[model samples]
Target: MGRIVALDFGMKRTGMAHTDEMQLIASGLTTVATPELIPFLVDYLKTETVDVLVVGEPKQMDNSASESEELIQAFLKKLKAACPDLNVARQDERFTSKLAVQSMVASGMKKKKRQDKALVDEISAVLILQAYLDRKPFI
Candidate 1:
């Protein structure tokens, strides 16, 4: 089976995560510059087969798409053009970032370290993938 990759795309950076080949476990990969994300994902696909690419879709409390959706939509066009055969999907990312911060606090990370946005981004990617996995009952 191929890995199921997840991305938490941001303005300046994008956090990446993936599941094992068996698709049983999820883990953070890394956070890369937003501009380089397409190339990075292209290179990643060369090394391992990826069944799906899950992009986090942010939503507001009232369930309307967030302003960030416009950015994500633009990226999606580029992503599809660059990786024509790669299957892409979207998952709700409503509270993943907040949850990531809470997880860092619960894990007893130092305050200075917990403030690292890149790390939080990476953790948020993992959380996004885990949420997708949870919703996929047959996976």
Candidate 2:
């Protein structure tokens, strides 16, 4: 079986996570610069087996798409162009960063460590993937 991958894409950095072949648990993978994300994903895909690409779809409190939606859409288009065979999906990414910060605090992570934006990004990616996993059963 192939694994499911998730992405928390940002303007400056992009975070990634993936599930095991059984798709049981999701874990943080890495953070890459925004400009390098496609290349990074391509290289990773060349070596690993990925089934689905779950991207975080940011939305506002009123349920409308966030300003970043345009960027995400463009990125998604580029990603599809680069990997036509891959299946791409989207999951609601509301309050993921806030939840990531709370999780770090609850886990007793150091202040310095919690201040690392890349770390937060990675954790957010994990949350995005976990949400997908949780909803997979109903869908």
Candidate 3:
């Protein structure tokens, strides 16, 4: 099976995560600058067999769209234009940053390391991928 990639996109930085070829578990990938994101994915896809691209869809606590949805939608448009044949999916991303921080604390990560926003973004991407995996039906 091909890998499944997830993206936690932000204004300046974007977090990335992907499952292994077996697609069994999700792992933190990397954080890239927003401007370079599309090119990076395009190059990565040339080398990797990615089956799906899951993007974090920000939502408010009341299930309304988040303030940054427009940004994401713009990004998605660029992504789709770049990889027209690519399969893309969206997963609701709520409280992922908070959960990532709690997880780091539970794992005994030092405050200095946990405070790294890039790391948090990466972890949040992993969480987003994991949540998508949990809801996917087994074949």
- Best TM-score goes to which candidate? 3
Model 3 regions more than 4 Å off: none
Q: Cα deviation of 134 in candidate 3 (Å)?
A: 0.2
Q: TM-scores across all candidates?
A: 0.98, 0.97, 0.98
lDDT of 3 by residue, 64-107 (tens): 99999999999999999999989999998899999999999999
Q: What is the lDDT of candidate 1?
A: 0.95
Give the least accurate 10-residue stretch of model 1, judged by summed lDDT. Answer: 130-139
Candidate 3 has its poorest 10 consecutive residues by lDDT at 84-93
Residues 87-107, candidate 1: write the lDDT tens digits. 998999999999999999999
Q: Report the lDDT of model 3 for residue 2.
A: 92
What's the lDDT of the predicted structure labeled candidate 2?
A: 0.95
From the highest lDDT down, the ranking of the candidates is: 3, 1, 2
- Tens digits of per-residue lDDT for model 2, 1-139: 7899999999999889999988899999999999999999899899989989999999999999999999999998999899999999999999999999999999999999999999999999999999999999732
Q: How many backbone clashes does candidate 2 have?
A: 0
lDDT value for model 3: 0.95
**TM-score of candidate 1 against the unseen true structure:** 0.98
